[model samples]
Target chain A: MSPFILICVFVVAFLLGYRIISNVPSLLHTPLMSGMNALSGVIVLGALTATTLAGSPLSVLLGAVGVALAITNVFGGFDVTHKMLRMIEGKNRQKRARPELLDA
Target chain B: MDATAYNSIAGILTLAVLYGLHLMSSVKTAVRGNLVCALAMSAGIMMTMYKDHAFASPVLCTAIAVGMVFGLFLSNTVKMIQMPQLVAFLHGLGGGTAAFVGLVILLDIGVANAFERVSACLALAAGMITIAGSFVAAGKLHQLLPQKPLILPGHGILANAILAVMGAAFVMHAFALDTLALFAVFLLFTAGLAFGIVFTMRVGGADMPITISLLNSLGGTSSAIAGFAVGDPLLIAIGGIIGSSGFMLTRIMCRAMNRKLVSILLGESSVALGAQDPAASVSSAPIAPKPADGENKAASWLTCAGKVIIVPGYGMALAQAQHRIKQLADMLKGRGASVSYAIHPVAGRMPGHMNVLLAEASVEYEQLLEMDAANPLFAEADLVLVVGANDVVNPAAMEAKDTPIYGMPILRVDEAKRVIICNYDDKPGYAGVENSLYRRDGVILIQGDAASVLERLIAML
Candidate 1:
C-alpha cells in the first residue's frame, strides 16, 4: 500500500474509534483501556513477518523475542480484562441471587 | 489470499472491533463486546498467519506458547489493586515488540524508500519511548521506584535538547544524508530512552493516570507507525484505533484533574513545593479540635441519614478498606438508608480504578455513581461518609485560586447536610491543598486508618 493510503486508513480509523470509545462510561474505563492495550498487540503481525524474513540468527532471535513479547501483551491484556469483567459479573449475579444476604 | 480479499476481510474485522467498542458503552452488553473483540482479534491473527505463511514456523509457534503461558500466569496472579501497573507493564512489552520490528526494518539493507525510512525512525522512537516510559510508570505504581516526582537538574532543558537531537537524527536518516543510518538509529534510540525516563520519573502518584494513558497512546502509535514501515494496512488501522482510544481517556483524565497535558509532559510540578510545603504547615498549625460530641454526632447522623454518599480515594485503597466499606454500606442499607459511591474520574491510580476495586468487594455496580451524576445528589444526602479521600472532595478545589487543584472538578461532599470524614490525617492530599471540609461546622473529622474507622462505624451501627 502507498503511504497516502496508509495515512488515510489511520485517520479514518482514529476518528471512528474516538467517536465510539467516547461513549464508554467511566465505569468501564479500566477494562476499556486493557482491551485497547490488547488490541495494540496487533503489531504481532509485523513481528511474525519480521521473523519469517530474517536471514541471520541474531535477527531471527530478536524477531522471535518480539513475537513472544507481543503475544504476551495480547494474551495478558485480554485475560486480565476478562477476569476483571468476570469479577463484576460474578458479583452482579451474587447480588441478584442473595438479596437477603446483603440485607443481613 | 489475494491482496483485495485480504484487505476486505481486514476492513470488516476493523468494523467489528468498533462495534465491540460501541457495545462497551453499556454494562449489560460489555462482556459480549469483549468476547466479540477477542474473537475478531483471533480471526485477524489467523488471517495474518495465513497471509504471511508463518503457521509452520517452529520458532514462532514456540514463542507463542511461551508468551501465552506467561500472560496467563500474570493475569491469574495479579491482584485487582495491581491492575494499573500490570497494564503498564503489558504496554511496555507491546511497545518493545514494535521497537524490535522497527529496528529490524531499519537495519535491513533492502529498504531505501524515504517514506519507509522515516516511518521506521518514528516507529523506533515512539516504541522506545513507550517501553521505557511505561516500565518506569509500572515501577512507581508497583512501589519498586519512589512514588515522589524526582526532578533531575535542568530537566526541561535536557528533555528539549534530546528531542531536538532526535528530530535532527530522524530527518538525517530519512533523507539518507551523510550520517550513517546505523549511527542515526543509535542516536534516536538513546534520545527516546532518555526522554521517556525523564518524563515518567517526574510523574508522582497523582499524575499516574495521565502518564499511563499517554504511554498507552504511544504504544499504539508505535505499532501503527511500524505498520506503515512494513506495509500492513490492518496493523496501521488497529493501532490508530487503540491510539485514539487512549488519547480520549487521557484527555478525560486531564480535564478531571484540571491539568494541561503539555505541562505534565514537560514535568512541570503544578505547585511550587518549597513555597507550600505541607509538612511545614502540619508542624505550624494544629488540627482543628474535634467537636466534643463528635462520635455521637457522627453515629446519630449515620443512623438518621435517609440518603448517604460514600466518597473513596487512593487512601481507601492504601488501607485496603473496600471490603470494610462494603460492610459499612450494607449496614447502612440494612437500616433503610439509600447509599451510593461517588467516583471521581481521577480517584485512583488509573481511570475507573475505584470501580474495579469496589466491584471486587462485590459492591453493586448500580451503587457506584460517576462524579457528575452524584454531585447534585450530595446536597440531598443527609450524610456524606468520606473514607480516606481528600482532594476529590476538597471544597478548596473550587474556592482556592492559584492552588494546584484550583478549578479542578471535585465531588460536592461539603455541600451535603452533614459530612463525616474518615481519613488518615488532617493533612493535605496528594495535591497538597488543605481540605476545607475539615473545618466546616457540620463536618466530623475522624483521623485514623480507614479500615478501622469503617470498622468502628460498623460497630456503632
Candidate 2:
C-alpha cells in the first residue's frame, strides 16, 4: 500500500470509530475499552508476517513471542469483556423474566 | 492471494469489525457484538495464515495455543474489582507485541525508506512506553505498588532529557546511519522505557483513570504504526479504530474530572491549591459527632423516606459492599420508598467501574442514574444514603474555591433533605479536598467498614 493510501485508510477508520464509539454510553465504557483493546491486538497479523518472513532463527523466536503476547491480549480482552457484558445482561434478563417479583 | 485480493478481503473484514462495534452501543446487543468482533478476528487470522503460509510453523502454533490458555485463565479468574489491573496488564502485552514487531522489522527486514524507518521507530517508542506505563498503572491498581505519587527531584527536566536523547536517535536512524541503527534502537527503547516509568511513577491514585486511558491510546497507536511499517491494511484500519476509541475515552475521563491532560501527565498531585483557607481543611473543620440515637434516627429516616438516592464510589469497591448496597436498595424499595443510585462520572477507579460492580451485585440498570440525571432528583429526595463514597459527593467541589476538586462536578448529595453516610473514616477523598457535606446539619455520618455498616442498617430496618 502507498503512504497516501495508508494515511487515508487510517484517517477514515479513525473518524468512523470516533463517531460510532461516541454512541456507547458511559455505562459500558469499561467494556468498550477492553473490546477496543482486543481489536488493537490485530497486530498479530504483523507478528505472523514477521515470523514467517524472518531470515534468522532469532528473528523467528522473537516473532513467535510477539504472536503469543498479541494472542493473549486479544483473547483475554475479549473474554473479560464478554464476562462483564453477560453479568449486566444476565441481570436484565432475570429482571425481565421476573417483573412481578420485583414489583412485590 | 495477490495484493489486490488480500486488500479486498481486509476491507471486508474491517467493515465487519466496525459493524460489530456499532452493535456495542446498546446493552441489549453488546454480547453479540463482542462475539461478532471475535469471529471477524478469527477470520482475519485465518486469512493471514493462508496468505503467509504460517500454518507450516509448529512453533508458532504451539505458542498460540499456550497464549490462548493463559488468556482464558486470566479472564476466568479476575474479579470485577480487579478489572482495571487486568485491563492494564493486557494493554502492556499488546504494546509489547507491537514493540517486538517494530524491533524485528528494524533489525532484520530493514526499513525501505525514511518514512518506514520513522514509523518503525515511532512504533517501538510508543509501544515501549505503553508497556512500561501500563504495568506501573496495573501495579498501583493491584496494590502491588504504593498508590501515592512518587516525584523525583527535577522529574520534569529528567523526562525531557530522555525525550531529547530519543529524538536524536530517531533522527540518526531516519537519516540512514545504518552503522548506528542498533545503537539508535537501544537508545530509543531504553529512553522510552525510562520516560514511561518516570511519567507514571508520579501519577497518584486519583489520576489513574487518565493514566490508564492515555496508556491505552498509546498501545493502540503503537500497533497502528507497526501496521504502517508492515504495510498491513487491516492492521492499520482496526488499529486506528482502537486508537481513536482510547483517545475518546481519555478525553471523557479528563472532562469528567475537569482536569487538563497536560497537568495530569505532569504528575501534579492534589496538593497544589490555587489559594485556600486552612480552616476549610478536613482536619481543621469542626466535626459534630453523631448522637447516641443516630442508628434509630437513621432507621426512622429510611422508613419515612418517600424518595431516596444512593451514591457509591471507589471506597464502596474497596469495602466490597455492592451486594449489601443492592440489598439496602431492595429493602428500601420493599418499604415502598422509591430508591435510585446516583453515579458520578469519575466515581470509581475507571470510567463506568461502579456500574459494573453494581451490575455484578444485580443492581437493575434502570435504577442507576448518571450524575446529571441524578442531581435534579436529589432535591425531591427525602433521604440520601452514601455508601463508601466521598469525593464524588463532596460539596467542596462546587462551594470551595481553589481546592484540588474545585470546579469539578459532584452528585449534589447535600441537596437532599437528609443524608446518611457510611464511610471508612471522616477523611477527605482521593483528591484530598475536605467534604463540605459532612459539616451539614442534615447529614448523619456513620464511619465504619461499609459492608458491616450496611449489614447493620439492614438488620435495624
Candidate 3:
C-alpha cells in the first residue's frame, strides 16, 4: 500500500474510534476513559515499530513523537486511577471506625 | 525483521492487553484498577522505545526508568483529594510536550513549510496559555491562591480586545512578517494567561469544577492543534474527544447550578453574599434539637419505613463515605425498603461529583436519580437520609429572596416527611451560608462523621 493509503487508514480508524467512544453515556465515561488510557499504550508500540523500520527521516521523527505522547497518556491514566483507589480505600476505613458499637 | 522491531511490537501488544483487561473490569474496581493498567502500558511504551536511538544506550534507558519510577512513586503517594490537581498537572505536561514537539519540528526543518510552521506556532501559544491557566485554576481550587476575584486594570472587554490584538500579531508572523510580530504574540499570550487566572479567581468555589473542565478542554485543543502541525491524526482525534467531553461536563455543571453559561463566563453573580449572616444567626437558634420529641418520634416511625432517599454532597466526597453509604443503602433494600439516591448537579465541587463517587461504590445507575426526579419522590418518602450534603438541600435557595443560593435549583428535601442530616458540624456550606433546612423545625441534625454515622444508622434501622 502507498504511504498515502497508510495515513488514510490511520485517520479513519482514529475518527471511528473517537466517535464510538464519545457517544457513550456519561455513566460509562470513567470506565471508558480508563480503558482507553490503557489501550493508548499501543501507540508506544506503534511508535517503536515505526521508528525502527523507517527508511526515511520523516517517518522516524513522526514515530518518535508518537512514542512520547503514548507514554504521557499512560502516566496520566495511572495518576488518576491511583487517586480513585485511595479515595475508595479511605471510605472503607472510615466505615470501620465505629464498627463495634454499631454491630451491638 | 530486526530484533528491535520485534521487541517493540511485543511491548505494544503487552500494553494493549493490559488496557483491554482494565476496560472489562467492573466500574467500581475499574476506577482504581486502571492505575495499574496505566503503569503497565507506560512501561510497555518505554520498552518499545528501548530500540530507538533515544533509548538504545544504557545511559538513556537508565534515565528513562528512573523517571518512570519517580512517577510511579508520586502516583501512589498522592492523596485522593489532590488527584484533580495531579490530573491538571499531567494535562499541562501533555500540552507542553505537544507544544515542544511542534517547536522542535520547526527548529529542525526551518520555517520554509508554512503549513507546519503556522500549526506549530498556534500549538505553542495555546499550549503555553493552557499550562499557565490550569496552574492558576488548580491553585485556586487547592486554596494555594485566594478564592477572591482578581479584576485587571481593565475589565473583561478590555482584556478581550488586547487578546484580539495579540492574535493579529501572531497572524502577521504567520504571513512572514518580521520577528517583531513574535514579541507581540508573546505579550498577548502573557495577557491571556493573566486574563484566565483573573477570570477564574473571581468565580466562587461552586464554579471551580466548571473552570477545571474548561481548562482541561483548552489543553486538549492545544494538543490537537499541535498534532495538526505534525500531521498526526491520532493526536487530533484523542484531543478532540477530551475537548468535547470537557465542554459537555461544564454545561452539565452549569445546568445543575441553574446558572447560565454566560453568567459563569462573565465571572459575576458568584459572590454568594447575603443580606445578613446566616452562620452567626444559626448559632443562637439552638444546639440541642429543639424538636427532640418530634425527631425521636420520627426516627421511631421511620424504623419500619418502606422507602428512603439518600442525598449526597461534596462532604461525602471529602469524607470518602460513598462505599459505606452504598452498603447502608443495600441494607435498607434488603429490609424490603426502596432506597434511591438524590444527586444535585453541583452537589460536589465538580459537575457529576456525586455521580462519580457513587459510581465508584458500584451503586446501580438506575438507583441514582437526578435532582428533579428525586425531589418529587422525597414528599412520598418515609424518611430522607442526607449524607454529608448541604446547600443543595437548603430551602433558602428555593424560597428565600435575600440569599446567595436564592433562585438556585435545590433538592426539595425540605418537603420530605422527615429529614435526617448527617454532618460533621453545623458549619456553613461552601457558599458560606447556613442551611435554613437545618434550622427548620422538622429537620434532624445527627452530628458526627458521615461513614460512622451512616454505619450506626444502618444498625439502628
Candidate 4:
C-alpha cells in the first residue's frame, strides 16, 4: 500500500477500533486482549508474502520464523481465550445443572 | 487467483463472521464465540497461501508446522490460573513476528522509497520493545521475576540518548547509506529491547496488568506497521482491531485504578517517595490459627458478628480457597449472620478477576458486591474477613498522602468493626506497602493456606 493510503487506513482503523472497543466491559478485558492478540497474528500474511518473494536463504529463514511466531500468536491466543471463557461458561452451566448449589 | 483479490475476499469474510462472534463472546458464551473467531482467523491465514504459486519451500512449511504444534500444545495444556502468562507469551510472539518480518523485508527487497524504510524501522523498534516488555511483565506476574519496580538512576536521560541514536539511524537510512542503515537497525533493536525492559522493570506489580494491556496494543500496532511495509491491507485491519482493543482496555483499567495513563507511563509511582519508613515494615507473627487455643478467640468473634464482608485478592487465587470461602459464607449465613463479599475492581491480576474465581466456586451472584456498594456498608459491618488481600485494603492509601496509592480508591474494609486476615505470608501486597489493617487492634491473622484455614474456620463455626 502507498504511504498516503496506509495513513488513511490507520486513521479510519483507529477511530473504528476506539468506538467498538469502548463498548466492551472491563470484566472481559483478558478475553478481549487475547482475542485481539490472535487477530494481530495477521502479520503471518506479511511474513508469507515476504517468504514468497524472498531472494536468499537468510530472507527465507527470517520469513519462516516470522510466520511461525505470528501464527503461534494467532492459534495459541485464540484457543487459550476459548479455554478461559469455557471455564467461565461451564461454571454457569454447572450451576444450572444443579440448582441446589445456588440455594446451598 | 491474484493475491490481492484473495486477501480482500478473505479479509472481508473474516470480519463479517468475527464481528458477530465477538458480540456473542460478551453477550452469550465466550467459549463458542472464541472458537468461531479462531476458525475465522484460521480461514484468513489459509488465504495467505497462494494456491497456484505454491509455497514450495519445505523449510518454511516445516517451520510453520512446528509453530502450529507448539501453539496447540500450549493452548491445550495451560491451566486457567496461568492465563496471564499465556496471554503475555503469545503477545510477545506477535511482536517477535513483526520484527522478523521487518528484517526479512529490508534484506530481500531494498526499500524503494523513504516510506518503506521508515515504516520498516518503526515496525522493528516497536516489535522488539514489545517482545521484551511482555516477557518481563509475564515473568513478574508469574513470580519468576522480582515484583518491585526496576527504576534505574538517570533513566530519563538514558531514554533520550536512545532516542537520539534512533534519529541518527533514520538519517543514515534516509540517505541510502546501506552499511550505516543496517548498523542503525541493529542499534535500534538493542536499544528498543533495553528500553522496554528498563521501563517495565521499574513499574510495580499493581501496574503490571496495565502494562500488559499496553504491550499487547504495541504488538498489534507494530504488526500493522510491518504489514504496511509489506503492502498488505488485511494485516493492517486486523492489527488495528488488536491495537485499539488493547488501548481501550488499558484506559478502562486505568479508570478502575483511579490513575492516569500519563502517570503510569511516566515511571514507577513509588520512586518519588524515596525510602519507606523502616519501623512500619516489621512483620508480626500471625495472630490466630497457629495454636489450638487461638481458634476459640477467632471463632467467638465470628459467632458474634452480625454482618461480615469478605475481601479477596490474588492470594486467594494462589491458595485455591474460593470454594472453602464459599462454604464458610454459607455456614455464617446459616447462623443468621449476614454475609457478603466486597470486590475491588483491581483485586486480582485482571478486572473482575475475583468475581470469576468466586463464581467458579459456586458463590451466589447476589452476595457479591462492587466497590461502591461495599464501601458504604463497611461502616455498618460487624467484621471484615480479608482473604489473601493486602494492597486494596491498605489504610495507608487513604491516610498516607505521600504514598503512590494515596489518591487511589480502595475497598475501605478498615472502616469495619474488626478484621481477620488469612494469607500465606505477611509480605504485603503488590504495591509493596505494609497493610496497617493487619496491625490494628481486634484484628485476627490466620497464617496458613486459605483453603485449609477456611476449612478449619468452617468446622469451628
Candidate 5:
C-alpha cells in the first residue's frame, strides 16, 4: 500500500478502536482498565519502532521521548492498580473475624 | 529487509508477545503481572537500539528495570490502607509522562505545524492538570489534606474567567504573539489546577470514587492528545478508550446519587449536612431480634443453617479480603448451606465497589445478587454476614429524616433473622454520622479483620 493509504488505515483503525472501547459499560471499566493498563506495554514498542524507522532526527527524538513517557505510564498504572487490589483484599480479611468476638 | 526495518518488526512482535503473556497470567496480583509486561516492553525497546547507538537504550532499559524492582518492593511493603494514595501517585506519574511526550514533540517540531502544535498544547495542559489534580486526590485520600469540601468564594466565576483567559491566550498564540500568550497560558494552567483541587475537595467521601474516575478520564484524554501530537495511533486508541470509560463511570455514579453531572461539577448540590430534626412519626413497631433462647449453640447454628448472605463494604476492599470471603462462602456451601453475596449499589467507597472487589477475588458472578434481588431473601437467610459494611445496612436511610443519607437506597439486611456486622469499630461511616443499625437488637457488631473473621467463622462451622 502507498504511504498515504497506510496513514489512512492507521487513522481509521484508531478511530474504530476508540469508538468500540469507549462505550464499554461502567461495570466492566475497572477490569478493562486493569487489563488494558497491562497491555499498554505496546506503546513502548510502537515508540521504539517509530524511532528506529524515522529518517529525520526530529522524528527520532519525538519517538524516543514517546517511548520513555509510555513506559512510565505503564509502570505507574500497574503499581497503582496493584495497590488498590491489595486494599480490597485486606478489607475482606477484616470481615471474616467478626463472629468469634461475639462468642468470646 | 533493511536492518532498521527488521529491528522495528522484532520490537513490535516482542511487545505484543509480552502483552499477551501479561494478559494470560492469572497470577491474581495486578502489580506483579504489570511489572513483567513493562519489563518485556522495555527489553524490546532496548533490543531495537542494539543495532545502532546502544548506549541510551541500555541506560533507559536499566532505568525501567530499576523502577519495576522498586515498584514491586513497595507494593509488598506498603500497608493496604496506603495503597489508594500510592495508586493516585502512580496516576500522576502517568499523566506527567504523557505531558513530557507532548512537550518533547512540540520542542522538536516547533510551532510550524498547526496540527502538532494544537495537539501538543492540549496534551501539555491536560497532563499538567492531571498531575496536579491527582496529587490533590492523593492528599485527600491519605488525609494529608482535609476531607471537607474546599469551596473558594466565587469559585464558579473564577473558574470561568480562568478558562476564558486560557482561550484568549490560545488564540493569541495561534496568531504568533508568543510572549504575552505564554504568560497567559501559564496563569490559566495554574488557575485550572487550583480550581480542580478546590472543586473536588468540597465533594464528600461518598462522592470521591466518582471524582477519581473523572480525573482518570482527564488523564486519558491528555494522553490521547499527546499521542496525536506524536503521531502514535496506539496511544490515541488506548487513551480515548480510557477517557470515555471514565466519563461513563462518572455519569453512572452521579445517576446513582440522584444528582446530575452539572450539579456535581458546579458544586451546588453537595452542601453540608442539613440539621433537620429526624421525623419520629413512623409506626413504633419494634422489630426485635429473635429470642436467642433456643438450644442451638454457635457451632450447631452454622451446620443447621440453610442459607447465608454476605454483605461486603469498603472495609472489605481495604482489607483485600474478597478471596477469603469467597473461600468462606464456598466452605459454607460445602457444609450444605447455600451462599450468596448481597451487593448494595453504593456499598464501599464507590458504586459497584463490592462487585468489583468480589470479581477480583474470582468469585462466581452468578452468586452475587443486587439489593433489589437480595432484600426479600434476607428474611429467609439463616445467617446474614456483613463484611466490613455500614452505611448501606443502616436503617436510618429509610427511617430518619435528619440523617444525611436519607433517601439513599440501602440493603435491608437489618430485617434478616441474624445480622452480623463485620467492621473494625462502632465508628460512623464516611458520612461521620452514627449508624442506628448498630443499636438495633438484631445487629451484632463483630470487630476484627474481615478475612480472619471469616476464616474463624468457617473453622467454627
Candidate 6:
C-alpha cells in the first residue's frame, strides 16, 4: 500500500476507535485498556516475518526476541483483559462466568 | 495467496476482532467474547505469516513457542491484583520490540523513502519513550519507584532541547545530508529515553492512571510507526486500533481528573498532585496518631452499625488487603449490616485501580460504588470504614479553599455518623496535605496492616 493510503487508514481507524472508546462506561476503562494493548501486540506479525528475512544471526536473534515479546504482550495482555472484564459490573449486574483460559 | 487475498483476509479478521472486542464490553458475555476476539487476533496474525510463507521458519517457530509458553505462565502466575503492573510490563515489551525492529531496518534496509525514514525515526523515538516511561510506570505502580513527583529546576527546558536536537537529526537524515544518520538516531534514542524516564518521574500518584494510559498509547503509536517502517499492513491496522483506544482512554481520564494533557506531558504534575507539602501531612505532625486513643475499638463500631461503607485506597492495595476486606464485607453482610464500597475515580495509584482490586477480590458488583453514588450514602450510614485511604476521603477538598485539591470532588466521609480509619500510619495521602477529617471529634483510628486489622475486626464482629 502507498504511504498516503496507509496514513488515511490510520486516521480513519483512530477516529472510529475514539468513538467506540468514548462510548464505554467509566468502569470498563482498565479492562478495555488491557484489551487494546493486546491488539497492539499484533506487531508480532512483523517480527515473525523479520525472522525469516534476517540475513545474519544477530538480526535473527533480534527478530526472535521481538517475536517473543510481541506474542507475550498479546497473549498476556488479552488473558488479563479477559480476567478483568469478568470482574466489572455497573450499578446493578453480576453473573458467574466460566474462566475462558481453560477453553483457550 | 496473492497480496490482495491476504489483505482481504486480514481485513475481515480485523473486523471480526473489533466486533468481538466491542461485544466483550458487555459484562455478561465478556469472557466468551474476549476469547473469540483473542482467537480472531491470533488467526489474523497466523494468516499474515502464512501469507508471507514465513511460518516454516524454524527460528520464528521457536520464538513463538517460547513466547506462548512464557505468556501462558505469566498469565497463570500473576495474580489479578497485579493486572495494572502486568499491563505496564507488556507495554514496555511492546516498545522494546519496536526499537529492536527499527534498529534492524536501519542497520539493514537503510532508508526506502522520506516517508519510510520519517516513520522509522518516529518508531525509534517513540519506542525509546514508551520503553522507558512504561517501565517506570510499572515500577511506580509496583511501589519499586516512589509515588511522589521527582522534579528538578529547568527540567522542561532541557527536555524540549533534546527533542529539538532529535528533530534536527531526523531532518538531516531525510535530506540525505548526514552519512551518520544511524549515530544521530542513536543520539535521539538515548536522549528521548532519558526524557521519558524523567517525564514520568515528574508525574505523581494522582496522575498515575493518565500516565499509564498515555504510555499504553505511546506503545501502540510506536508499533504503528514501526509497521510503516517494516511495511506490514496488519501491524499498522492493529497498532492504530490500540493507539486510538489508549489515547481516548487518556482523554477520558484527564477529564475525570480535571487535568489537561499538555500539563501532564510538560512534567508539571507536582501541582497536579496537589499543593505544597505542608509539614502537617507528615506522620510526625502534632495531631498525633493517638494509637491508644482508639485501642482495638474499630470492631465495636462495625458490630453496632446499621450501615457501613468502606473507602479503599492505594495503601489498601499495597497492603494486599482486598481479600480480607472482602471477608470483612461478607462478615458484615452476615451480621445484617448494610455494606457498600466507595470508589474514587483517581483512587489508588492508577485509573480503575481500586475497581480492579475489588473485582479481583470478588466484592459483589452492586456493592462497589462510584463516588457519585457513594457520597450520599455516607450521610445515611452509621459507620464509615476508611481503609488505607487518605486523599479521596479528605475533607480538605471541600473545606479548605487554599489547598490544591480544593475543587476536586471527594467522598463525604465526614458526613457519616462515625468514621473509623484503618491505616498503617497517620501519614497524609497522595495530595501531600493532611486530612482535616482526622482532627474532627469522635473519629476512630485503627493502626496496623489493613488485612490484619480487618481480620481482627471481622473476628470481633
Report how far off residue A82 is in candidate 4 (Å): 1.0
Each candidate's DockQ? 0.78, 0.80, 0.16, 0.58, 0.16, 0.47
TM-score of each: 0.95, 0.95, 0.70, 0.88, 0.68, 0.90
> lDDT for model 6, on a 0 to 1 scale?
0.76
Q: Give candidate 3's error at residue B181 in angstroms.
A: 4.8
**Per the 3 Å backbone cut-off, how many clashing residue pairs does candidate 1 have?**
0
lDDT of 5 by residue, B1-461 (tens): 35556435543543453343333233243335445545654555455455434455554455456556655565456543454455455556556566555455544445446776676677666776677777887787777877555657787777667666657756655665657556645654565566556556565466676676667667767766665665554455456545664565676666555457787676653332542111110112323323333212433555677898989887787567788888877777887889998877556544445666676665755677867788899989997878777767878778877666677678888788877776756666665557887777756666556676566666666
Looking only at chain B, model 3 earns a TM-score of 0.74
Question: Candidate 2 at residue B7, lDDT?
Answer: 96
Worst 10 residues of 2 chain B by lDDT: B274-283
Query: What is the TM-score of candidate 4?
Result: 0.88
Write out the backbone clash pairs for model 4.
A1-B231, B150-B201, B150-B202
Q: Determine which window of 10 residues in candidate 6 chain B has minimal summed lDDT.
A: B278-287
lDDT, residue B244, candidate 3 = 54
lDDT, candidate 4, A57-86, per-residue tens: 888888888888877877787877776566
Model 1 interface RMSD, in angstroms?
Answer: 1.1
lDDT (Cα, tens digit) per residue for candidate 6, span B327-404: 988888898988889988878655677877888777766677878888888889999998888877888877777766
- Per-residue lDDT of candidate 4, residues B323-370 (tens digit): 888888878888899998998777777655676677667676557787
User: How do the residues B1-461 of candidate 3 rate in per-residue lDDT, one tens digit apiece?
Assistant: 36556435543543343343434344355454455545555555555455455556443344335445555665666554554555555555555455445444444433446665666677666766666766776675566876544555557676567567657756666664556645654654565555555566555456666776666666666665665564444444445545554555666666666678887666554445542332332223334533444445545655777888989886687668888888877777887889989888677655445766785786766677877778789889988888878778887787777766777788999888778887767877656666878878667787656776666655566
TM-score, model 3 to reference: 0.70
TM-score of chain A of each: 0.89, 0.90, 0.57, 0.87, 0.57, 0.81
Better of 2 and 6 by DockQ: 2
Model 3: fraction of the reference interface contacts it also forms: 0.12
Each candidate's fnat? 0.79, 0.76, 0.12, 0.62, 0.14, 0.56
